[model samples]
Target: MNRSLVRHWIALLLLPLLAACGTTPSSQHYLLTAPEAPLPQGMTPSIGVGPITVPEYLNRDSLVKRIDSNSLAISSTERWAEPLEDGILRVVALNLAGLLQTENVRLYPWHPKRAPDYGVKLRLVEMDSNAERVVLVAEWFVYRVADDSTVARRLSKQSRPLPATTQNGNEVAAAYSELLYALSQEVAASIAEAQGNPAAVSAPST
Candidate 1:
């Protein structure tokens, strides 16, 4: 056979092998979810939670875990179904809605005319899991928008122990959800303090 013919025949024979090699394992996607519960039946000021920021490194769709204090690991086969910041905002809103017993919950990017009585700001300082535990740390603030005042400020950090036998992202996602719930509770306490004032302010929902 000519050189070109020989090369063509070889390429045809390798096609199936290349196709098989191209098949990759399906990735596992995970979501952060809070406990299922009812919204508070009572009427309250509208609440806005937003501008929750994450580190540039943690902004990717992949799930991240700590290797050591200075090292980290990104899972190629495990990923987030949505942006991590959005997930955190959503879970925090759900948690606050249940804890505050008010449906006046909102996420960020509030309507121009809709100003929330209070705003929740959060910065994700650290979020990582290792073989033993998952840790979440944030610097948060509660603001009174009407007066442009900061009503509360806190540095919140939470750690949850993972089961020794835990082996997947679901467990880690669950742990993150729990940590978010706990953090929302802390913000709720601050809101409760702000609610004592006679101002009529509502929160923003995204």
Candidate 2:
């Protein structure tokens, strides 16, 4: 081969190697935690939940990082908290449906054949995570199906901090689980009160 041709081939071969020099692995995953316990008892009068309403800001790109406001700084691609919210809603529905009995509890997709006596609507006002703690705020309303009147309304808030020596997915999942559990209990308590079941009006914090 000619000398110049040999040198040109060597430079072409090295170009690809140089292009591959700077690369980094992504360090994030989409994870969510399940609820901790069963739903509250005595949720009679049959209730149906409407489509959950999330804050507009939560629907934007980078949902997880945007919701995890507690973090000092989060990568643009991190997606931890948004999935956590979805998990929480699913678990809450499952637990409540089981405890209240499927016949008496209805989730989304209200059926004409299985019309419930009351409808439940939830609005997530705030869900943010920080290094020290996570904060959640929500409002719930129970409407009487017959009259279409709001029979009960309540707002709940919770803040939980990370345990010492830990900052992993498991810890985050557990924290989210606890927060969901709390919200479910509050909703159940309000339902119980509306039903005039004083005994069911109080739910265990645990």
Candidate 3:
């Protein structure tokens, strides 16, 4: 090949390497956090939480933001530090541990012989966030482990305003954590009320 053609071929090979060397944004991972305030004094019952399920759209690693009613934007550079459902379970368990004042909180699928007194099953109907706000809708059920009888069932819907200009995933995660905390409080109250603890009925209102 001529010198010019050879040089052109060499340029083509180096183009990708040059582009790869350019500053590329790295992925940022975020995690949901639970509250750390001192728990109330009470002898909470053994509880199990889980089989937590998320929507198919939210089962991915990227952070999903709703652009409109029919549109969504999945970030390529912002991601969740762990599976969304797993993180929800972890945070909810922690929040329940605090709200219910119990150390016997366990995730789903525990040993059959060591079943908790009560079991919580959750299905996340919606968890969408945009610049304007973060919204969560969930359906949860409480049932007795020994008899498999229903104790309580409720649907929780909550939202928090997110600053219009905020694009950070950390804030979004924090808002989600808050929603989960509220849900946990409600679940704690359900368990308490089932045990005939009427004082805890309105204590978890937030």
Candidate 4:
């Protein structure tokens, strides 16, 4: 074989190995935290948050993504369905526990020694994100565990405008913070009302 041809074949064989050496798998995880809400007065209810039910549409491979006029694309390097759902539940529990003047608020997957006085169950019906706004619709029910009766049930909707020029972590966090804040407040007020606090009846209006 000609020396030039032999050199060319050697270069071709090394190219793939060189490319593989430069490629490193990403080890990043996408997570979102819920913001705190105002605490209700004179209450120490031990609340149990049931599994959060998300809609089929929102249960996608991509937890974070971008939708433009032309196409929809994922933002994260990896897509994890279980972690995102677990993260959402954790955030919700954290927000609620912080907002309420409760002795303790525990996330489910726990077998309560005794049934909690009140339980919070949520169904996330809609969670649509767009360039202009993020709209969320959730149904919540406050149940009395002793009697297995619903003390109160409410359907809450929140819509927050997204920043037009921002597409980074801070912007996304801010948007989620606002939405979770609204949701936590609504849940807190409902629990207060269930505890017979008349003041809480109108707390969620804002």
Stretches of candidate 4 exceeding 4 Å from the true structure: 2-10, 13-28, 36-43, 64-72, 76-82, 198-206
lDDT of 2 at 96: 54
Taken over the whole model, the C-alpha lDDT of each candidate is 0.86, 0.64, 0.87, 0.68
What are the TM-scores, per candidate, against the unseen true structure?
Answer: 0.87, 0.70, 0.89, 0.74
Tens digits of per-residue lDDT for model 1, 1-206: 79999999999999999998799778999999978666477657678999889998899999999989889899999999999999999998888787777788878888868888888999999998999999999999999877769988989999999999865899999999989988887888788767784332223233
What would the per-residue lDDT of candidate 3 be over residues 42-112, giving only the tens digit for each residue?
54588898899999999999999999999999999999999999999999887877777777887899999
- Candidate 4 total steric clashes: 0
TM-score rank order: 3, 1, 4, 2
Candidate 2 runs further than 4 Å off: 1-23, 26-31, 36-45, 60-86, 98-103, 201-206
Scored by TM-score, the top model is 3
How displaced is residue 30 in candidate 4, in Å? 3.6
| Per-residue alpha-carbon lDDT of candidate 4 for residues 1-206, written as tens digits (9 for 90 to 100) | 99999999999999999999789666344456665344545336878887788876557556444475445555554444345557667777777766665647767655757566778788887665666777778898888877779878888998888788855544554576578668877887778777788464323223
Better of 1 and 3 by lDDT: 3
So what's the TM-score on candidate 2?
0.70
Q: Between which residue pairs do clashes occur in model 2?
A: 70-129, 70-130
What is the per-residue lDDT of model 2 for residues 117-197, given as tens digits with 9 covering 90 to 100? 877778889766655666778888878877788877888898788777755545655676678667776766666677787
Quote model 4's TM-score: 0.74
